[model samples]
Target: MGRVAGKVALVTGGGSGLGAADSELLAQEGATVIVTDVRLEAAQAVADRIGGAAVAMALDVASEAAWQQVIGDIEARFGRLDILINNAGVVVMADCEDTTLEQFRWVNAIMTDGVFLGCKYAIPLMNKGDGGSIVNMSSTGALLGYPIFFAYSAAKGAVRSMTKSIAIMCQDKGYKIRCNSVHPGAIETPMVQEASGRAGQAQAVPDGVLPAGAVGAPSDVAAMVLYLASDESRFVTGAEFVVDNGLTIRP
Candidate 1:
């Protein structure tokens, strides 16, 4: 049951959806979880639910200054940061032709740049102890050509590549850090629910998009995160773990 006991985890976007689930699950496994989101009140609510095992903080993932401040606070408070989950992301559903420069930049800033900053800052703190694990949340869009989500797919593609780069760099530099990306497809989150409405569909995954029933829950992804954060995946790095209900392999 104690998958990550005594670890210190910081989950960006920990206010709702997958982030809230990740925070709660991490705390349940005996880790001190720092829940950070742009929505301070929502973050606080998640933390309160986790009781003494968690704390809430405000973070705008696109800001380098905020990243620095939070990492510093983690070092000061926990003395060691064992896990960093760069799960903060936004999806702009517009095809390549219709997407604007602003939309493209905004998505990349949060999904790509945010993950970069988290790894850049958290590595040193992780190195202080036994090294740490960094989990970047990508999407099935990163692996496929989803015409409906041009910008999101592009940003998540960058995240996937960056994860591999970080993993190799750490290996070469003799840091014990492990970096990997998680790609989830059609998960049951507010984001997906919104997407469903916009796409004029009853379910987030269209009938033929997946081989069979394909929607999943936040806890499904959290279980994978826990394994990555724990010592169980010590040798697993530079990998893309897909929790897509076989959607990627279909057709």
Candidate 2:
């Protein structure tokens, strides 16, 4: 049952949806989880429910100072970091022609810049002991043409590319750390629900974008995260794991 036993794992956006599921699952499998979100109460609520070694903290991923503080705190308390889930993100439902510069910057700041900062700061700590795994949450949006999610797609694309770069760099340096990207499609998460609600639909994708019965649950994605976080995936790095239920392969 202890897939990640004795490990310390940090999840960004751990307050709700996919983040909450990831935190709960990781804790259940034996990691001391740090659940961080911009919403303090929400992150704390998730941590409280998970109990055990789970803790919650407020973190604005867009801020370098916040990243520094959280990583420093983790190092002080845990003495080693083992896993990182860079899953904080925001979606703007604006097409390229209609997206404002501010909106684009905001989405990239959280999703793209956030992942960069998490890896930049956490890697040294991870190196201090045994190197660990970094899972950057990308999306099907990064691989497909979603005109309405212009900024989100761009940010996720950056995440996908960055993951590969980090993976290779660590490999070359002989660090034990591994980096990978996860691409989820139309998962039933709060972010997807809100984006769908804005589009006046029951699901985030248009009727034909997702194949029939292809919608996924948060556990589906969390399972993938678990594998990546565990030693089971030790040989896996710089890879894109798609949890889209075959949606990415549709003709």
Candidate 3:
């Protein structure tokens, strides 16, 4: 227990799926977690489940004002921020040829722009304390192009790139902040399930997506976030951690 004892963490999209798992585990490890999601009720549910170690807040990641308000509230209440997990995202399936500019912009607004805003606002606050860990949830799609999820892949790719840039900037400036991105593949989450259904596939693997005999759970990704959020990975920054069960590897 107490893997992140006394730390303060803000997890965007903490209402459900991998975000919920991360929030619960971080609290179990003794961190005061702020679970923020656009869906206030869902975030509240997560906080209620975590008891005293968590609080639910409403945050529209695409809005800079919302980000400022939430961060300000965290500073006032917690006095310092030690961890920021930019996990809020959406996956929309549309071929490159069919995706409209509006669609692309919207996807990037949430996945790409949201992370940028979070980092921009949270960095100075994090620097105020002992510095902090920033974990951005990229996907295997970021490493490779998925024809059906073109915009999602593109946005996540930007996230992967931006994470490295932030990591190096912090390192160069001598800040103790460590920034990293996580690439998850075919996890059994609602978002993945929705994409699978849209692709006319069952919940089970559709051949080439997930490797044979490979399966993933929210806890799989959450465990990696826990390590990154903790002091155990102090030397790690500008790195990509793949929790995709070798799905990105080709024979």
Candidate 4:
């Protein structure tokens, strides 16, 4: 318990799925959590349930003004920011040939631009206090080509690369903030469920397709996120950790 005792974490998109799991885990570990999402009511609900030491805020990851506001609020309320989980993302799948400019820009704005803004704004807060950890959520699609998800893949790929750039920049600037990205493959979340249902298929990860036998739960990804957000990975940075249940390397 208390793996991150005395720390404060800001989890974007904390209203649902993996973000919700991450927020709950961080609170359980004795860290004050800020559950931020574009959905204010959803964020409030999660924060209220976590109780003890949690707050809710409307954090639109794609907005620079919102980012600034959240950072300032964290500073005023928590005195310092220790962890920034850049988990807010959106995936609008369209074939490259079918991809519209609006569709492409929308996904990239949130997935890639949001990560850039988070790291850019959070680094100063982390540098001001003890060095903090920033965990950006990418996907296995970023590493592998999924013909159905052209824009999402591109945005996530950009997120992965952006993570590396942030890591190198932090090292050069002597900022103690460590940046890394998480690549989850076919995790069981509302989004994935929606995808599967849209496919009208009962199975998400079939036996031969996924070595794990089934899709992973949000908690499966939360465990890894906690480790990254905690001091356990004090020296890890610029690395992309894949929690795909062997989907990435399965034959």
Candidate lDDT (C-alpha), each = 0.91, 0.94, 0.93, 0.89
Candidate 1 per-residue lDDT over residues 1-251, each given as its tens digit: 78899999999999988999999999999899999998999999999999999999999898999999999999898899999999998888799999999999999999888988888888999999889899999999999999999999999999999999999999999999999999998887878878878442333434433455568878889999989999999999999999988888878
TM-scores for every predicted model: 0.94, 0.94, 0.94, 0.94
After superposing candidate 2, which stretches have Cα over 4 Å from the reference?
Answer: 198-213
Q: Which stretches of candidate 1 lie above 4 Å from their native place?
A: 198-211
Instruction: After superposing candidate 4 on the true structure, give the runs of residues whose Cα lies further than 4 Å from its correct spot.
Output: 198-213
What are the per-residue Cα lDDT tens digits for candidate 4 across 1-251?
Answer: 99999998999999988999999999999899999999999999999999978999998899999999999988887789999999987877679999999999998888888888988888898889998899999999998989888999998999899999999898998888888999998877777877767442334433343445468878788999999999999889999999998888877
The clash numbers for all candidates, in the given order, read 0, 0, 0, 0
lDDT of 3 by residue, 1-251 (tens): 99999999999999988999999999999999999999999999999999999999999999999999999999999899999999999977898999999999999999999999999999999999999899999999988768999999999999999999999999999999999999998777778767767433335434444555476888889999999999999999999999888777866
- TM-score for candidate 1: 0.94
**Best model number under lDDT:** 2
Q: Per-residue error at 232 for model 1, in Å?
A: 0.6
> What lDDT is reached at residue 46 by model 3?
97
lDDT of 2 by residue, 1-251 (tens): 89999999999999998999999999999999999999999999999999977999999999999999999999999999999999999999999999999999999999999999999999999999999999999999999999999999999999999999999999999999999999999888888778767432444434434455566778888999999999999999999999887877879
Residue 103 shift from truth in candidate 2, angstroms: 0.1
Badly placed stretches (over 4 Å) of model 3 are 198-213
